[model samples]
Target: MPGPPILTSPPKASPGDRVAVLSPSFAAPGFAPAVHEQAMARLADLTGLTPVEYPTTRRLGASARDRAADLNSAFADPEMRAVLATIGGEDQITVVPHLDPTLILSDPKPFLGYSDNTNLLCWLWTHGVAGFYGGSTQVHLGPGPHVDEVHARSLRAALLTGERLEVTDPDESEDVGRDWLDPRALHEFGDREATEPWEWAGPPKSVTGRTWGGCIDVLQWILTAGRFPADPSVLSGGILLLETSEELIPATEFGWIVRSLGERGLLEAVDAVVVARPPASSLEVRPTKQACAAHRQEQRDVAIETIGRYNPDAVVVVGVPFGHTRPQWILPYGGSMTVDGVSRRIWADYA
Candidate 1:
């Protein structure tokens, strides 16, 4: 199969523009109406854009075809200048195949989402359209005391202004979050742990390329569905942006996933890899602080080791501010990014 084109960043949405907020995956809004409303309010407050919902935006258990139709309508509507997912979900892969590429191509707008939304982002990338990789309405905008400055700035750049921005590591980060069902979820943000400085390995050099990759498990699903490029060479010189989700796969399993990528020749093809800090604890797991720390360390070790096995020359940076964590950084999926191992700096071209 032919490689994906050098995707173009779609037209940015201006203030006062109507941005379609849809639940392409899970109907998060259905379960957390307060959170969803707060998110819409936050989006308007932060970006000066109007949040318009689609037919299936808050309809719980909507079929894949219905979700795809909502997405199609969002993309096709001339009034909808951008599209944002309410939140990520596990079965977005089912919804992707139902989408009509013609609709997206005819009126490509800034599509913002991450995690399970990776499926749609990759789909758009395959069709030569770039999207922002981290902007869930409920997760980032709602439920917190305030929208994170880093997240707000990145979202602003992606939506209102097409400007290049530096991706910085947050001083503190959190994996655990408040329960959406709890009344406190409207304004309370859970505890955060002190973050470590990003660790860099491999060749002490800088490389710039289009960004690719997303939540590792979601990417694995996409790969399993054969949605990614058939030829790994297409990703040559690209920066691999990967992170684990709340599920928090074991270190051995994570290694196996990375190894599988290597086997498919993806690791050797990319110039650099940026692994977001894995969420070490979750409501379900609820590990102790020490255990969380240990889990994170093990994840980092396995990632570095696995990448070294396949491509020792490739630059690998760990502890990026993205993924299923608080204080997330919104990155341009398929957009350009610079990874400087020697200087230990990262810059993304949001434009």
Candidate 2:
């Protein structure tokens, strides 16, 4: 029931530093070695950092305890400057309780991931170590024909230097991505969709605070498991960043989830809420262009209505390109960010 501690940004990694790329969730690397190899190549090409893999990094059926052990090893290794997830999976929540917080706290290093990896980020935040909330090796680096510039810039800022950088929407985005199992997936980046300008709502003022929240469904799981800080006040004055995953939950379900947060006093505690563009089309369920548009609009309306009911004064922005969508931006899980409703700009201090 204690609130989350004051967060401290971890030391940045420099070029030539050794970074650990592990599978703390599902071992997607084991199933798709070609994709994993490409991702490692891209990581090296983009940042000039050496990637070291752990025992569970490619062990498909590794247990939660084994994954946690890899995390412990990564944190305790002096040569390892940072830890990155090979890719996200469905049950990283199972790995959380097994983590050795003392090891992580003793040598805090930047951890990068999204989706199911939200569990780990929330765990680190509670222990006061800030993490970068995007940059999955498979999704961001492997499947695509080339690395995205937006992602590349944000990754560099998060890992190399501390600087105030503006978060901008990518010129293009894709809800559907390539299939890692297919060889052609390496050459196909999926179709690019025409992007709409970000929609802003609420007061015409700016709010600066530490960023929190992640994939909505994963956050719900975290809350349900009692893994999040029990004290809601810890989120007071902070900025809430929410996004949906490929599951593309219905608008009503999304509203219900937001309502649950409101009932828990989370919605009212934040200064602003930023919603990422939902991925309406998935590999299993590819909707038509018209259907995708309608789905996105309904989600936007539901989010605004739900937030308005809980905290009318909170600033809100939708479609910020930081989710399952392509050309994603890396957000600091517990680092400083400025949300300016007046200027319609968002800046993050990646320190």
Top model by lDDT, which number? 1
- What TM-score do all the candidates reach, one by one? 0.98, 0.98
* Candidate lDDT (C-alpha), each: 0.91, 0.90
* Per-structure clash totals for the candidates: 0, 0
Predicted candidate 1 versus true structure: per-residue lDDT over 1-351, tens digit per residue: 444366878888888999999998999999989999999999999999999999899999999999999999889999999999989989999998889999888988999999999999999999989998999998999987999999999999999998888899879998877999999888788888899878889999999999889999988999999998789988988999989999989989999999999999999999999999889988888899899888988889999999999999899999999978889999989999999998899998888
The window of 10 residues in a row where model 2 has the poorest summed lDDT is 1-10
TM-score of 1: 0.98
> Model 2 off-target regions past 4 Å?
1-4
Candidate 1 lDDT for residue 272:
94
RMSD of each: 1.1, 1.3
